[model samples]
Target chain A: MTAVPDAIDQALGIAPGSPLHALRALRPEFVSGAEACRAAVLDPEETLDLSPELRRAIARRVVAGAGHDRLTEGYPRPADPALAALADGEMPEDFALAALARHADLIAETPAKAGPEHLSALQEAGFSVPQIIALSELLAFACYQIRVVHGLGLLKETRA
Target chain B: MTDTIPQVTLKPLTWTPHLPPVEIEDATPRQLEAMKVTPSAKKVSPYVRTLAHDPDSYVARTVLFNAIMYAEGGLNRADRELGALGASLINGCKYCANVHARQHARLTGTATTSALYAGRRDALNPRDAAIMDFAEALTATPPTAEQSHVEALRAQGMEDAEIQDLIHSIAIFGWANRLMHPLGHSD
Candidate 1:
């Protein structure tokens, strides 16, 4: 079956049937999800009103993505001594993967405790759900970019 | 004047399985009371209470809650519990991990708390596994998340709005993971 277009593709001008399409097609749920997301972004009240099932599905996706990424990026590789040490239950300087995952889950589910002003600011800034997702992607990319630059010695030198 | 030789001593850092737990005695009675009375019934340790009490300054909490409640499309109790497990696993906060894992085990009657604490994927339900993967990506790597990454979840029958909310959930968790790493008490 042909995969549905992703909201990112629709928002960012990526064409359907391109690599993005193929990638999104990898997950059947994601294909239909992209369609639903497109509708929600297009019309929040009418199309994307929150439902219990939708919420659960969303939570599942977010947690899965984050968990996969943490395993790949945050931890030491299998060949590394650090990895072995960690697996053996040694305390690393940083937080463990499990703790991070839990924290991420909690943060994602917390309600909008911000005052009227911040909420208004976000709304005024055209912060729809898709836009928020885009921002998140942007932030992640920014962190990655900073790490790349720092690794390359492009960042300013600081005293240790 | 004769030059004196400088002496340098290297102290080897020892790795410990557990951190010295944060002491309640360090907190004031009011703070202790707040910790005791917080809604979760999970004692908000003094450190978490310190952060929660200053609700105005804890921007992360507000943003995270909104993302979970509104952007993530409003997770149910089970979903929230699962999300909590996923985040705790990724962050490796022993205290939080132990607490949430126990809760998850109690609720789901599946994986043991130890397995969850170890980040053992095999022990989790398939849906929970998928959610865990999503949470890790959102927390650890955003830009590298290929279109396929999202598609995988969709292939599993997730809807579009749900996917968007999922992203929000990850974003919120990502923010929280960082905050808790340095500021939260786990000992």
Candidate 2:
């Protein structure tokens, strides 16, 4: 029986065994930030029993991670009216650029080299201590995978 | 919060080609000015701006529009408002919550919005409650929602077209809520 954090209990409505709970069980030092983010972004099935504040916190974390470079990358770069129309007034150029830049940085940062700045950002965004730890752990794992992939030239190959 | 009760007035809006116009002739001058000030009051993101061209054509407004216009038996404005509120609540979108809740309060009165914000879906009348429940399930766990959910709404006297519109409203808000949540705070 794992002791679940109160915030997780409050946000998700269900007790432990929730996806968020699984995320919490992993130790932060053992994992990495990028991995956690990748999982959160790619795994749509993952349920987050996030409170309004926590949800805002996650959004803030993603936003902060998305540095200024990513913020300005507009969709269709030069500008495609059709894509813009499909954006349906949702995707703005500046916002896209910012998000892209941040995601790139997060992907570039090494897990072993990560510092308090990363943790502090999540904390300021309203992540419970447990969630912060879990995210860090996941990020470490992601970074490890990235390193392996980069070494093998797998990432570049896949991109090509 | 002022405990002093503000006088409640009913001002029905009629739909126009571009947006629905709020006729506030019965509202106090202050209230009317406040309404006019809402759009220009803040610098909105490109996302929000595109959704709301006029005061009445907001994303939530468009959702309600489609719901009322295309629903089978047709949903009343109040039901559409409640649906928006329920979806916003499920998505955990404070901005949408603020917007939809205010509209709900304006149309259905403060008491109703109070009950909803308090998380008391059962307290609402059966019809409205069903709509809220359906909207919540749809937004929170879309794939898991079953046919019975739609059937339950139909049993409550909603038409197929109305249910389709309701589903569309829920789906649309799911996307809109995510966009707003992530981007709303930004300049």
The number of the candidate with the highest DockQ is 1
**Per-residue lDDT of model 1, residues B77-148, tens digit only:** 444455555654565434444554555556665443444445455765566666666655544433234445
Residue A130 lDDT, candidate 2, scale 0-100? 33
Candidates 1 onward: DockQ, in order: 0.03, 0.02
What are the lDDT scores of the predictions, listed in order?
0.38, 0.40
Give per-model TM-scores. 0.39, 0.38
Cα lDDT tens digits, model 2, A58-138, are 232332222222211211222344323222323235443233223324422321223335434544555543333323222
Residue-by-residue lDDT tens digits, candidate 1, A23-127: 334434434433343233222332223332322222333333333332223222334443333333343343432332232233333312212343234335444
B125-148 in candidate 2: lDDT tens per residue? Answer: 677777877777655431235556
User: What lDDT score goes with residue B146 in model 2?
Assistant: 51
